[model samples]
Target: MNSHSSDKKGILRRLRRIQGQVSGLERMVEDDSYCIDVLTQISAATAALQACALALLDDHLHCCVADAVTRGGDAAREKVDEASQAIARLVRS
Candidate 1:
């Protein structure tokens, strides 16, 4: 029933990589790595998270929003509104 069900496995794999990046970042900080080195790792982690967000957004639009629009009526409006809010949050981040 999930919007990203088709690619759930792929998404999870990416998430796990991102999680590893974060853990590495924490280790870098704990080990007192050079400032620039820590910053580079942070950037990598941030980019990974952003990519994950975008992928999920694409899946939501193609699956959940598409289905809602096809059904028509209030469900479509709700989905559109929900998607808009999600986009806004993503952009703000």
Candidate 2:
């Protein structure tokens, strides 16, 4: 099973909310909203996305990485590497 299965609903809900926020941002742009206001909304949306990423990373460490460590050998090393790459991407972002 997926590591985040337990949080699937919550993650989806967060994503849906972000989607709405993006739509609202589009409308604001279309209506020529103030620059600061648009930038603020963009920041809020970015923060929400980061929050979701953090939650998923937590789940991955607790579930996927934990499981891989238990299994040992190549699987364990692969999981560790995958997690490292994920962290790197998040850091770059």
Model 1: worst 10 consecutive residues (lDDT sum): 1-10
**If candidate 1 were superposed on the true structure by all CA atoms, what would the RMSD be?**
1.4
- TM-score for all models, in order of appearance: 0.94, 0.94
Give me the runs in candidate 1 sitting further than 4 Å from their true place.
1-4
lDDT of each: 0.90, 0.94
How many clashes show up in model 1?
0
Candidate 2 worst ten-residue window by lDDT: 1-10
TM-score computed on alpha carbons, candidate 2: 0.94
Which residue pairs in model 2 clash with each other? none
